[model samples]
Target: MHHSGERGERPAIREKSRGIWRTVTWRELAEEAAALAAAASARGLQRGAHVALLGDNRPRLYAAMCAAQWLGAIVVPLYQDATADEIASSIESAKVTHVFAENQEQVDKLLEILPRCPTVRCIVYDKDRGMRHYKQPELVSYASLLQQGRQLAAEKRDFLQAEAARGTGQDSAFVFFTSGTTGPAKGVVLTHASLIDRARVAAATESLKDTDVAMAYLPPGWIGQNLFSYVQPMVVGYCVCCPESSETMLADMREMGPTYFLATPRVLEALLTQVTMRMEDTGGFNQRLYRAGMAAAHRIDAGKTVSLSDRITAAACSLLIYGPLRDVLGMSNVRVAFTAGDAAAPALVTFFRALGINLKQLYGSTETGFFVAMQRDGQVKPDTVGPVADGVELKFTEQREILVRSPGMFKEYHRDPETTAQARNADGWFHTGDAGYLGDDGHLRIIDRIKYVGALNDGTAHSPKLLENKLKFIPYIKEAVAFGDGRDMVCALIDIDMAAVGRWADKRSISYTGHADLASQDEVYELIAEGIAKVNADLAQEPALAKSQIHRFVILHGELSPDDGVLTRTGKLRRGVIAERYRALVDAMYGGAKEVRIDVEAGHADIKVRDAEIIGHRQIRSAA
Candidate 1:
């Protein structure tokens, strides 16, 4: 907020307000945050108390976050899409006594869960269009809260300033929950210094200017959002734009022309699927032109010389197709685009770089403030995460687990010192729990999660995540989970991309009503089999992974979703939970059953049972 004084009259944030774009300057942002801070103070939000922030991305939401920090309170950002029960768990865990709801939707959710959380004392709301009749004593309108703050300011002019001055860099700025693949999520406590330093280094590396624009779409509860939309905006004084809603993200992004962008592998996969589907829907001439342009682009190696003919073709294609394609994807102005949170497909990386997007893979975790290894300019490697980031040190364990130590390393897990001690050794090196190796050029190639890396019964090592990533690159497969740990052969559970595969089916005159019906179709199974076979062919090329080829596979009747507890909020598979939930299916594959009947819990309340045929396509080859 202090940056507002140094950089006056510049737009600090922008978002759609009532169907029109509304911008807030840095000066206005500070004023708004200060008022909110005073109001929160008036509500008995004392120092070190946790303020739960529940809402979609909004200018007022960001202001409240800053306000809470300014008043020396820790901000806890809850996922707006989480179930009421899940939100209650986070609120209870954090012992949050105050909540800042975005609108009536979130307020209703809070009200539903309020009976279970007795500690909550104040409920401050932003949008009150439909909430004029709410008479709960805890309920406070945003305008009224600001009015109270103004009255407090009149009585004590230095109250907010004094609170801000009392804050130290080591104080807990916020606590972000882990994705919780293995178990219940743990809160990772990050301090002001750690987060600020990480953002500073990143901004310096990218040479971000105050004039740069970035989209704020990722869930703010995640460290990535904090770094890109929150910390970097404050550090570099750039404008962070929020979309009206999740559905309008692409449209809003196209209009904003963000200069800096970061998206998870899943998001990139979706965008690629959209692009491919759109191209297939175009006329014959346009489809042929896209294919030709892509072929030309592929010929121009990212870091190598191109022949005169190939160069000319690529330039022509750029002018005719690739350039406009980028504009349509809202990446025409992206100075640096990254895909992280897990390994991105090498194919996706090559595809984007081939189109001149400067797309790179980044490697980090929530505990590291989300900056560890980043691809640098002219050092892009599709198979590696480039090099260790500035101000970070990395080493591998005997078991090949990556260990990181950096100035920006997190302080500890909130209220969980035992787990914190286990995460970091006495030397302050934090175990990343990811198995990887360093290339000759100092780039880091992540294999998979350390615990998930295993060998077959005969001792041929394989990485399930590595294989899964390869399968996901097929575009027909949306999610893949490989199982071979201590087993004789590898098998997989595949989730078809409903949109992409459905389109393929429609083009072939196939009929289907829903995901379940379409996935069960024999033709769809054959298509998935083809994709798995391609992955097997690629696995055969690797000497160490050949024996770990998928010997059997089954297409799931439904997608693995967070609602069913099969996936975490960040889209990570809860492997342990999945294995337990599908124990019967796993046994059938190993028991030599050719088919299995499985029951899938549709959501929190519905169960859907379906029969699936297990197909064994064992192309097990020996080490070359």
Candidate 2:
């Protein structure tokens, strides 16, 4: 709000609505937030009351967040894609007194869960096209809410300002829900001081400027997006662009030309897959030129050291191919890009860095307000999340579980004192639940979840996440689950990326109906085998991990989904659930069966039967 008075017309948030770009200037944003704060006060929302915001990337959601904070209320961002059951649990747990829904779809979800959350007194909705017929007492149009605020503001001009003045740094800022891969999601409580302090530190570390632009497309519920799109943007006074929809994010990014970019490993993989598929389609002179240029560029190390001849070739390639390719991927103007939340494949990381993009990695969680370790300029390492952030201290347990003591560390788990106590020690160190160690260079290399790190009977260690990331680097592979704990050799169940593989199949003139039919093809099996072989070749370089090579594998009948109880909403595998659900398939691979019949249900009623074809040797030399 202070920045708005000094810089009245600067754009703070931009978004596409009905195919046209619309911007919210800083002054206008402040007015909207203040008005909304007045509305909350009129609706009897008190200090410390939780306000749940559910929506896709939109300006109103961000404004609602600021408005809640202005009234000294804690904001809880719920995933727009969350199921009704998930919504109900979050609302009940947080005891949300107010909600901001973006559209009728979101309002419907709120309606479904309202019976379980009786504390919800006000439900304000934007984009009310289909909501005119609704007769719910608690439902209020977003425009109406603003009007109510206007009336309240007229009655007492300083109402919002007074509320804001009453808030303190120690007050709760927001509540973030963990991905809950192992169990039910936990609400992590963070304070205003922790978030603002860390946001400033991150901005300084990156040398962020008000001129820098960012794209907001990830789930608002995730801490990664919350930090990048919400906290940092506010602290640095940068513009955050919201895409029209999930399907148009890349196009929007390209048009907006964001200077700072952050994507999850899955998003990066998808983008890389698109580039690879496009390159494959280019033929003759262009294809040869691209291949030659990329080969020359690959020779240049990530640090940008290059021979004279290599530099010349690289510059020529950037002009002819690399520059346009980066533009198409929405990374041409990206000054500092990062991939985080999960292990990114080394191949994917190096692929962009080799092309002169400053793609780096960071490691943090909701508990740390999202700033723990970050890669600084000119110190990129694909194998590790770089050095600890300024003002953060990092250590490890005797078992190698990462522990952190930082100013940005969250206060507690909301209403879950027992879990909160378990997350930290008496000395105030927060247990990260991640297995990792500091490298000789001071970079932190994460192996896997502490409890998920396993070993073979012969004592060779295995990190399923590491291996799975390697597999995902292959454009055709989407997700992988490695199993070998206490067993003789590692094995895997793989899900092929249908979009990329489908394009490949079309290029080859192969006729296939759907994912299941295409996956069962022998040719698709060969493609998966090729990916596994590449992973094994990489593993051969490390003696300790060589034994962890996948000796046997099976192609899954379908993609693992959150609704299926196979994957969490954030894409982390529910390994125990997956292993038990597919026990028959797992047994067949270990029992020396060539192929096993499997039954998968599509949605609630459609029964689909397919065969899990095992295709590897026990000795691990070659596929059988």
Q: Best lDDT goes to which candidate?
A: 2
Whole-model lDDT per candidate: 0.84, 0.85
- Cα lDDT of model 1 by residue, 82-122, tens digit: 88888898888888988998999989889999999988999
lDDT, candidate 2, 506-620, per-residue tens: 9899999898888888888888888788788767656667777777788776788887878777777888899999888788878777777666565321212223322334434
Residue 487 accuracy (lDDT) in model 1: 96
Q: How many pairs collide in each candidate, listed in order?
A: 0, 0
In model 2, pairs of residues that clash are none
Worst 10 residues of 2 by lDDT: 604-613
Estimate the TM-score for candidate 2.
Answer: 0.95
